[model samples]
Target: FGDGSFTGKGLYHVDAFEAALKNRIDENTILSHDLLEGALSRAALVTDVELVEDYPTRYSVDASRHHRWARGDWQLLGYIFDPRGVPALSRWKMVDNLRRSVTPIFWVLACVAGWTLLPFTQAAQWQALMILSLFMAPTFDIVNGILPKSGDQTPRGHFSALARDTVFGTALVALKVLLMAHLAWMMGDAIIRTIYRLFVSRQNLLEWRTASQAAKGGNDLGAYYGMMYGAVIIGVVGLAIPVLADSTGAFVAFFFAIFWI
Candidate 1:
């Protein structure tokens, strides 16, 4: 704490001195002078430097009590710490963290199950079902991530801002996914080449490629290729099975695709 008395004394002196100085000072500049004096008092409240084992280092003054009195100016610090003085990463943020963790699981499971189950119900619905399921994964992922937890308490203003950001962010993600899927549909080989490019860009994939190349170059290409190929395989198989099934055969095919396959 700025020598507890110094902060108060400084403010008092500033007000008194400024009141005397005001007669000679232009009224238009009084606000600027008041701000300067307030800053000086704030500085006096804490020593210019604190010594730890006699080594001088800049220090922060305890301003929790004064922060509430700072009006609109101090509200900015609320971004750093809430009214509880706990930062955003604190355990008190349980609701936000819980929602973040649960969203991915919920969306992944829903899309996986839907793809695995829905296709066999109607053979004619193969194209619609596969494409819907393929797109649903990313769509649901983005939606759940952006959606506010019904039970969570958040500042109304912050939540509104977050909703606005989510709108634009989700649109961008959807656009990317659409373009990728379109390119994949138009040219199957392009997807594999794009995977190579993706492998180069993503550090994890690059490491996987290096390890695989070291282990057995060209020998286990099938296994190495299958890593990125799984998603496309799932989608293509989902699309193909319905084509092979008869009108009523799709019922059994759906069960095989979802549960057995």
Candidate 2:
């Protein structure tokens, strides 16, 4: 697709070559990952050459853009279980994509569980364990995306590395807490839609939907509020679990949910 137009995030970073080298691709998929997988299977020489990409600005545009991407990445799952010529690194990347789809769901569950279960459950240790599992899954992904090689640069001691990852991870998440809930909803929707497609309607897996904003702006405030209504409602509902039933253990979760609102 980058026979060159400033495409979205991943496409701009695609590994491309002329027609002769392009013939290495097995499937005619739109995703750069798919294309890269096909090329890598055929032993193509690869290198990193950064290029400028046009990041989507409008929220609707950005969401629609990533929705297409989520579909594309999910489509790679078939290769994961039945490895056919895909390299080890590429295969693991497919597994990582699966984790990405589920990570948001884990985040939502963590917030809900921390707010509700952690406060009232007598099995305090178990509840905290579950909450930590759900909470840290998204944090690991966040930190991984921000610094893929972070593990290598950590101090030599094992405990020290973990402590640093947690401290830095919490601070970083707090900075983007506002967007975290939105991302959780968006990626959760992607996971649900992907599941439905896998079972019910296998067609249109490759369909690409671009965000359209052809109409000129007038009172975008109404449109803006209309879009955010769901988020506001979710924040209010999620907060209720901790706000009304506040406890010592739930305070951490409550504090996070305030920014989430």
Candidate 3:
């Protein structure tokens, strides 16, 4: 709304809309897709809205933008459940919004839980299997994309292509997962703090600022590369863990590896 990314386009009555903004909506709410869409949906104005091609053109810029949007979604989640005078949104709509709102939280928790559980499981086979699965999980889509369609290519050609795809895809996936985990951790921490300030401590939302503009200037890139390097270090340590002949050494290494996750 501030950047002309969204416009009313004369779709609703001007006076009613202005009154809603002044009285119903929280002025301090972060300008976000969820806030706008949720408010409109709750008001039963589901039609005549259009999404424009206003996305950032660069990957770095897009990532930075999404970082903020992720926080905004978390903020919206509080609004969804608050006792404040939000309109009666449909149950299905609320559930959908809640899922979208908490995606980063869920991802962060899943990664942390996966890492936390790794050390406790007694079965060595299961541990190895889980590691292998993480490595292989991101390759399925690439393999599918590169596979030759029926009657389209030679079997040998498909096999060669698949081998190449697997190699590249696995590396890319590993990098992406590690970076995403780091970003999720950063975002999740911010969201948690914001929740604590806004709801748990009963602070005024208008006075709260979870992240300052200066802090965000380079965190997106920094977190990505920092996590990637950390993953590499952890992977090296994990590879060396199996070489330790003693069960106690292996056990400690196992916990260390899990802690890395």
Predicted structure with the largest lDDT when compared to the true one: 2
lDDT of 2 at 40: 47
lDDT of 2 by residue, 25-80 (tens): 34544353643444342333234757676676676667666666777777666666
Steric collisions counted per model = 3, 0, 0
Shift in Å, residue 247, candidate 1: 10
For model 1, how does the per-residue alpha-carbon lDDT over 1-261 read when each residue is reduced to its tens digit?
222222222325657666644544223312112333333232344446553433212111111111112221211222224323322333223334234323433433343444444554443365344445445555665567565666565678547856766676657554433333222222333223334433354222212122323334333546433333533554446435544443353453444334312
- Give the poorly placed runs of model 1, Cα more than 4 Å off: 1-89, 92-95, 115-170, 175-230, 233-261
Best to worst by lDDT, what's the order? Answer: 2, 3, 1
Candidate 3 lDDT score relative to the true structure: 0.50
Residue pairs clashing, model 2: none
State which candidate has the highest TM-score: 2
- lDDT values, one for every candidate: 0.37, 0.57, 0.50
lDDT of 3 at 200: 80
| Model 3: colliding residue pairs | none
